[model samples]
Target: MCGVLPIRKFILLFTIAFMFHVSLAQEGEVASLSQNNLQTYIVYVHKPEGLHSMQSESLHRWYQSLLPVTTASTEHQQQRLLYSYRHVVTGFAARLTGEEVKAMEKKEEVLSMGLHPEKGFWKKSNFDKGVIIGVMDTGVLPDHPSFRDEGMSPPPDRWKGRCDFKQTANRTFVCNKKIIGARSFQVYDNLLHSFSAQPVDEIGHGTHTASTAAGNFVRGANLYNNANGTASGVAPHAHFAIYQVCSLDECSSTDVLAGFDAAVEDGVDVISISMTSLNVGQLFEDSIALAAFSAMQRGIFVVCSAGNSGPSSNSAYNAAPWILTVGASTIDRNIIATARLGNGDEFDGESIFPPNSTKRLNSKLFPLVQPGINGQMLSQNCNNGSLKDINVKGKAVFCERGMEVSRLDQGKVVKAAGGAAMLLVNQEQKGFTTYTDPHVLPASHLSSAAGLNIR
Candidate 1:
């Protein structure tokens, strides 16, 4: 007792059901999803237990069934697989950009003489006159008093020129009334891109190094201290130029090579590089090395650091036969101590006997004590006696080496106790060495005797 359905109605119902089934199948095939149109998501499938029983094609089919149709394109599927495999194998979210990795590697190459005796001896020679010391670190600070001259402004002029290599109109030039010439080579976007036109240093390392190499001795300039500083460069008053080859993060081999080429073209006298790297294979094609060789062929001296990994047998860059590799040493003779007091605190010792009621907190004190001043106290305080007596919590702590604990570890303990700054008194053995640790706030080292007097 059913009425006969129309042929057209039956056909329409069949088509609608077929379309719905197709849509469902397509939805199930998408491999991934992305929020931004420009960005693509990558998906990795987990391996099933005892999956060795399955063939490669069977495994791929199993993964494909979990994705949507839109994401089943060969390219997208490949990307997902690669991303997943890499993540699982490495167990890291993302790797450091090439530039950042390179910068860290170069730090080991940039050696400091610290406070070595031979540091002064190098100044006696005129070798730096024709040498070109390329500081491939931070941007140089143009306003630093160390760089100021008579009738010279603190912040110098900025260089003007295009730096993009892909552009035909690109011309690299830097101008500071004193900066005769400059050339920029921006090749790699990840590492070698120049950020500014001014040849000023954004980081202090470049300034310190440049000053160490060729900065003139200014009469009233406060080099390290406000006193009439006289720590002249190895070759002060020498004509020099800068090759801005480094930034805050990384420097590329390509940029370095271009800078070397420019220095060679300019006929630089000597090349000083404060950078090192573990990629020995890159040295052969390294622009710096090529430039060093070309300069050497023309009788230019190439000097570099022996690296900070001291006591280790690894040979640092520029330690090769063709280059001069310098090491670090201690320079300050006396022991020194620096202490910081809380809001209401005072410090007293045999050499430094301030009244207990004296406002020691909120005060920065550095005492340089000599031998025989507080003979017994100095000997007893060699380890942690001086620091232990200071009640350093919410204050500053200064300790000398020779303690049972590592200097770095001791500094950490002081930091944990709410100390502001931790100064390490140099041990008698190394003489003068630079201490650089990213942890434990701003820190410096003083001589042993100086530290005792400060307490």
Candidate 2:
């Protein structure tokens, strides 16, 4: 994590949410849809001033009233309304037909509507005190040392969020003043469920982003004696309200909106999100954009990722003008390792795989083989089942990076195939850029040019 300057002014950052796989309804195109086609649509309504003063139940009722009534069973009607947006916007996400949507649009209170899609450094005294940054991603590990509340003040009295994490027998995830609030919005997804009933970060993404945003100072922070130093977030004193919206596979648009509703209602100072869908539609057609606009209106800042389909023309996502779109870039620091060939040629590379303190690779030379050279499909990617026929026993297997295969998976494949080590070559599109990854075996990620030379 790079050291970021302390946030002197109240600059809010926003994150784009969800990996939307469903096709989106284009603007003014809903009228052509079949009248009976029932799909989830995000409806935005004009919020009357002083609506916040109303009771929560009353607000929910107001949103419920906007939903078209049906003669079906009460349970069926209740299921139509997926989520209500009180904080992020005055709206609701519901299952509506084309005719029903057209009817809703005619209402005077209806402002706009859209389709639903499915998915930093320390500063002690300058530490952003009292600022609450709402993280919308995977759930967090509340017990991480980065979120310790030492020298941190309690959240301000206006904070209405609560910790929803429950203790389990194996581990106890506790929350303090630093990690003020934690909640999960995985109730909408019927296919994939949250790893736990609580808002525990099953994946490390939430913990990583949370720490990077406002983690506390921890000494000797390093991964296997590399990048060793004191680690702290950009704003050590800022409070975090984690809203877990993603499951293992994808983030549901309904669940994400619920999270946004809660985060905005929680009175967070900033909204930071790192997830993005493969496709981002027009401004009004995207739920994230609509919700972000509401957050901006409420004086909250939003920040988002520029997506991973980069190094390609027009590959950037989350390019909305209202939110800050951040892209990945190289920094000065790198984890140095080397890929030395049997031919006495050496290529300096990067890897996070820790070397044994007593062992060195220079003493021995293993046969270097490329799995796909013998004409096996996907062997270059080192995908599972692709190396079954390849005999890489006690040899250093060279693999290509990409093809929707992760670097970790590639190393795992090599390790499983009885390979001694792995040499990961970046695809041509990646050019000179290389990334360090924690592999299951000894591995080095070499740039595209070096990989070509080795080949």
Candidate 3:
């Protein structure tokens, strides 16, 4: 699951939302955009079984033949064709105006196509041996201990994917047997100019997900001395591939489709996607749903995040029956952190930022202040620049959780304002669920009830 591109100008953030009727075996119609505005559109074509094994150059020419001839130069027309997909689906992604899309839809071979629009463990056994799991996220950290290939066999002979993390001036990445392939689809987006073209993970989400999927065993893994123990993915013996479809904060639908196209062609047994649109869309119109349908046709297991708006009614995403839609679930353990108020009221919470023995904050009770006592809207969340008026030096700042503000960022705001500690309380919707986040300052995430008492 990921963002969807609009029919016109490509925005930084694209999300899929719409309803349409179309199936791969039948002809489908599409709404047209203004010809003046040109953008990338996924074009699905009916590929013959013989074409499935065609050479790359032969396939490219077949895709190019579908486009209408124009007065533009050959090189200019070539640039318009972005990708020629053969496995995930018989299609191509190209820069086209509404007029061009209208023309392509008329082709008898074209199937339904639209704007480009997710895990888990098991018994440690041969259940995952010779299996290949494809991860479509930001990317992976090849050097992370979890991905090291010690004690692992080489990838199966059927594997066709290859790593694309070419050595650059300042960065280098290598793929081992455990992580057999790592390719980036973001280069086609051209929006990420600051980052390198390699498939290295800058955002930690991809690293975490990859490590949780089929990462190799790493002994004595822990965060800040918490949860100390060996860590390993459920499918420790499974070969995996990384498809970087997301950037720092955004994911384009076209890029994500390209990832699907590659993963399917690469012979992955399972494809894991942990991103989704804000709302649900039609099966054929949504990019992920469509690509997943093609992947399902190829016998690939598709697992997708049900979206983050969980614990809410109708919050499910990836509703297509062919895909396995998963959501968050509670674990058996917790990393407890205690917050003691001046009045001797103690609240037990959670935090992954373990206590540093050198800086014992429990020795004495520090002054605690709630910045929102005066009813300042932003102060309640400890947003940046919201605590400037509050004198919280040498004190612990109590903050309420708010939308669009990360818990660690709230701690940064409190710490920047000279506060000694942070007590992050959850919103009503969050209830008693507290995340064990690593905070910049000594912090504890409390529940809604705890927040009310603190208030």
lDDT at 432, model 1: 45
Tens-place lDDT digits, model 2, residues 17-127: 322112334423443343456777778887678776787778777887776656145675677777776677778877777777888888888988866332112211457
Clash count list over all predictions: 36, 15, 6
Q: Which numbered prediction scores highest in lDDT against the true structure?
A: 3
Q: Per-residue error at 101 for model 1, in Å? A: 64
lDDT of 1 at 338: 30
Best candidate per TM-score, number? 3
Off by over 4 Å in 2: 1-125, 190-197, 277-280, 341-344, 367-393, 399-406, 427-429
At residue 289, candidate 2 shows an lDDT of 74
How high a TM-score does candidate 3 get? Answer: 0.66
Over 292-312, each residue of candidate 1 has an lDDT whose tens digit, in order, gives 676688776676666555576
Q: Which wins on lDDT, candidate 1 or candidate 2? A: 2
In candidate 2, what residue range of length 10 has the lowest lDDT sum?
5-14
Model 3 agreement with the true structure over 1-455: per-residue lDDT tens digits: 87755622112211112111122321112213324466667787887667767888898888888887661557856878878886687788777776777777888888866553201124323537788989888888788888888888888888999888777787677888888999988774454365556888886878887777777778998889888898877677788799988888777777888899999999999898878754335666677888999999999989887665656787777788988876656767898889988788899998877667415887777888888766697998899799998899999888999886888899899989999888999999899989988888889999999989988
Q: Tell me the spans in candidate 3 whose CA falls farther than 4 Å from its real position.
A: 1-124, 190-197, 277-280, 342-344, 357-359, 372-381, 385-390, 402-405, 427-430
Candidate 1, 94: how far from true, in Å?
A: 69
Reference-based lDDT, each prediction:
0.45, 0.76, 0.77
